[model samples]
Target: MIIEGVKLMFVGMTTVLLFLSLMILLIQFVSFLTRDATARELEAIQKERELQSLKRKKKKEASADSDEDIAVIAAAIAAFEAERFART
Candidate 1:
């Protein structure tokens, strides 16, 4: 009975480790795909979208903007509309 329990424990541990490794690999693959953009063009596109939304939001609001809002807008514009770092 003791031998059987030991065997089962080992099997369970091995299975758990295998499952954990597979999960780690899947997470890594997903992150890589999320971060990758073809020739960095997609990053530019995404930044443009961010800037457009920020503009629309600012236009619709009449309240005074804080430094945070200006900073965010600047960041979006810098990311999207920079000619020096064009994705070629």
Candidate 2:
């Protein structure tokens, strides 16, 4: 009967709507449960990046000191060469 078909359609639609709503709720619950852990992971990655940045800054400073030493060595070599020519 047409009336029975209409009733069946509505029932089916309602059932599907309820199922979809339940699925959405379950997904939201899982996301909420894992939120803290995800936040912690992000914080740890941020800390690691900060540490790497600090290490790079220290390496740059050390390299600057070495550059000064290299300059001094070059000057000493130049002076030695000049004295040797003066003596010859």
Which candidate has the top score in lDDT? 2
Q: What would the per-residue lDDT of candidate 1 be over residues 1-88, giving only the tens digit for each residue? A: 9999999999999999999999999999987886756548887889999999999888667345666688899999898878657975
The most accurate candidate by TM-score is 2
What value does the lDDT take at residue 8 in candidate 1?
A: 100
lDDT (Cα, 0-100) at 7 in candidate 2: 100
Candidate 2 clash pair list = none
TM-score of 2: 0.67
C-alpha lDDT of candidate 1 relative to the true structure:
0.85
Query: Candidate 2 on 8-46: residue-level lDDT in tens?
Result: 999999999999999999999999999999999999999
Q: Which ranges in model 1 have alpha carbons more than 4 Å from their true place? A: 37-88
TM-score of every candidate relative to the true structure: 0.43, 0.67
In model 1, pairs of residues that clash are none
